[model samples]
Target: MSIQEARAATEQYLPGLIAELKHQGLMQLEHAEPAQLCQLFRRSNAAGLLIPQQYGGLGASPRDTINVLRAVGSLCPSLAVMMTMHHHTIATIVQLGGIIPAAEDLLRSIANNQLLLASAFAEGKPGSPIFNSSLKASAVDGGFVLRGTKKPCTMSHDMDVIVAGVACTDTGGVDHQGFAVIFAEGANITREPFWKTPILRATDSNALIFNDVFVPDEMVLLAEGANAEEIEASAQEASISGLCWFQLMVGASYLGAASALVELLVCKRGVQDTHLAQLAIELEGAHQALLGTAGTLEQRQEADAGLYSQALCSRFSVQAAIERASNLAVELLGGMSFIESEQVSYLLAASRAIGFHPISRTAAAPTLADFLRNTGSTVDAPEPAHV
Candidate 1:
């Protein structure tokens, strides 16, 4: 389907979102943190976009989800990036919902109340693995007490729930990696200024300090492993599913940002036909890659290392297209356009932020190489520490 059609479908799920965002204007949306945009999202019941219908949600399909993200990215790239964190968290919770009754209840509450969720997976350290969180947890009487911090936690200010990866030490002294669902209510969570960068500042990605935060047993989901190295098969599968969804949606969002620039070119008629065609081909190719990967995952109705590898490959490809398209669009738009307005420059900077996301090209190279060499290899394996 066309981008227009995709946007129209997005409107069906998030009514009046695009209109309201436009009303807020591009400069305001891009320059400041997205508290108001997030509120608008909550009002539009966007929290239920991925929740199953049975759980009082929209149960939007993967294709529709990608479309909606792309539409949002075109308007405000930060919101789109933050929403990927939210949606991916939802996907993970839903995948594990069968075994966790509390998580299912949480989903219903999220759908009914339009509560926003934030993810704290990456710790913002160089060469650190994505899943290897520094947030520490110690076993306590009814639950566990969390300590440490999650830097660059997207949706930090407005999130009602924060799902964080924790390095937990159990009563038996077994150390493992797991997720902790910390509710905002009565929790000891605090925010600190962390995201100092001007690029994508609207995401509100700051440091969330869990100061002796108490998480009950019901709010924790742990993988079956004697140590971090031996994560259970089921947990690994769920993680693969969540990560695949993350890559697809995140890639589409940046594509939309690049498309915004290309659309401006088309509207102004400033570029030659051949140049326009080149931009279209790159952007459309990236779009189809995302859609095709989403479709494959949907049809399979399951996630594995192979599909996850494909998703990573598609995401990197999309990243390359975004960079190329943004560069070309800015150059073709001319210096006058650059000096006159922030639209071209802002989008260029924002679209390139996709490369900064987890599983960077450098990190995934060896894993991808392994996958390419052996078709039966698992892409869900832990990344090398040096990445």
Candidate 2:
């Protein structure tokens, strides 16, 4: 669908989600049981919120996804984050083209059943790189046997799919990074609870241990050898587009948290106009950055190295703006904001999750600095996948 149509369509789901939130209330929502939270989202049709209509989802574009996520964050940060994890996996798979027939059917199930996909990508032991993995995905006869663990796998309780990023080896022992989408009930998958914080207590961020899990050939998406430059190029295109969407959606999720505080500030303590105005400008800048990046994807410019740099840089900026806005709202609202409401504390913590994801400013700084000194302008990089 066209972007305008996608925007209009996604906007329709917000009222229902918001209405459900109001009925649930902040205190109850903040303290909801995991089962209740899952049911609430299901009743609110939250699972398919970002999926396109063709596949049985809301069919939201990046712009609309941002808008909807921001709105969701205003009321419920946990839900917002859970949705981001869900959308990131699904959207990335969709972005990275070349899905097999089985994967296609799984997407249909996602769209039709509103079933969730807990992201098992970019996760590993302490200090492990996000993209690199150590999963033992040994290429067997017609498929591969995977043995590893996915830490902090969100949506563990209710997800219908387990999409993990793994390092694969061919018979020739050549290595490649590929995504594995397995049915949630697929054999040999065990769940281990690991989250200890009460802030996002309801998110099912746990360990998913895969022991001799056989992933059939149809469920894998991998890049070919360097010799097949055409295939490799296509994989790179998918990777860049997928990463851009993942980063932008994450920023949107937190922006919702910041916006929640802003809404609260607007309703009470009417004298802090200056801080509010400054925050408004920052929010506007973030929105424009998101809008421009979405437009780039829509225009099919995902193959450009400059776009990768731009998208990653934009995510960092968006994150900083959201944190600044959240802090401003907290200051204007004063200590009582946190002292009076448990909800406020939740909002503050949620907004601070900016650096938790991969490619944060701290992680991407050296590359960004290199880009400035050697890559000329911000829009001229030639290595999309690396950037």
Candidate 3:
């Protein structure tokens, strides 16, 4: 099907999936095991959303993938994230070209419900140079020996493949040719899960350790000094367009969670005061802005080529959605919102965790600074009316 048709079909499937999730008690905001999450993906129809038709995926566009993720997120952000990372792995493999020895087979497995892949992009802490990434691979006679510990790898437990980056440690520092992107089968890897967080407990975003893993020459998606600029250019395009879709999904899920909280409010306490109503309107505006951005990105219209603007807008949406959703949930649900059983609490955790995901927050400074410098002046701002 065409991209547009695929996206529409995805949209049509969401409400039913949401209802099913609620019915199955998956929406109870509970922790799920890695195996269980993987099974959930297959059962929820999420596993086939992004793989190419030739390889077993739905062959959907980035837009369609985002829609599927948004639907999943609306029901369960943990599931949403797990699925997002899975598709991202596929997208990465496709981006690097499927010529790698087992790459095609991996994608086909995903298409055939035989494999799952997670992204191991973020390492160490959020922004530290050391934490940035120290993974390295050296050129060997027959193949490359990969070594490094990648932290915060999504879906590390059940994933069958990992698309990770390694910085070259040669005398030459962080040059374009100073990096290598490698794909490793999950069997050769080890992981330690991070479960202290309340949100996305099932995401299994954990640390991955690679000990002298041998990847055949054919398995190297990207090699040292191999047109580094070209790969980065592709990644930039993917980030501004493809990856942006995931961010949009994040916003949509936040909006849906808040919508559910609002429903619970209506059932419990009747109509809310005018202020809460106004807040609802504001939240709705943010949601509309998010969807509008998604539509614009999907079209790939030249007018939407403003990468800087799009990125900043996405950041603002995430922050605004998190704040609005949190405030509204607390205001509407009152003290009970803090309880784990409450939907608001789970939604709150999801929003917060997503807001801080390494990939999403890397632009905090630049995005905030750009938005701040481009805004209206204080002299022209409207004053608040007396309470």
* Candidate 1: tens digits of C-alpha lDDT, residues 1-387: 256766897889988888877788777888765787687778878899999999999999888898899888888888888789899899988987865558899999999999999988876665555677878988789878999988889878888998888887766877777888889877888889888878888788888888999999888767643643444555677788998999998899899899888888888864698998899888888888998999998898789988999999999999999989899988999999998978888888888888788877777888799889897563577777994
Count of steric clashes across candidates, in order: 0, 2, 2
Instruction: Give me candidate 2's TM-score against the actual structure.
Output: 0.87
Residue-by-residue lDDT tens digits, candidate 2, 1-387: 122232344448744667677677755776777667767666767677656677777766677777767667667778877888888677766655454447556767877776777777676344334566556687788888899988777777777788777887777878877777788775788988888888777777778888999988888766665544664666566666667777787777777677777777778856566776797887777877877887787677354556767777888888889888888888888887779887777788878875687655666666667766666664665765763
Ranking by TM-score: 1, 2, 3
Q: Each model's TM-score, in the order given?
A: 0.93, 0.87, 0.77
In Å, residue 197's CA in model 1 sits off its true spot by: 1.8
Best by TM-score: 1
Give the candidate number with the greatest lDDT.
Answer: 1
User: Residue 321 of model 3: what lDDT?
Assistant: 62
Q: For residue 381, what is the lDDT in candidate 2?
A: 52
Sorted by lDDT, highest first, which candidate order results? 1, 2, 3
Off by over 4 Å in 3: 1-16, 26-29, 61-64, 98-106, 128-132, 170-186, 223-232, 239-242, 273-276, 301-305, 336-342, 359-362, 367-387
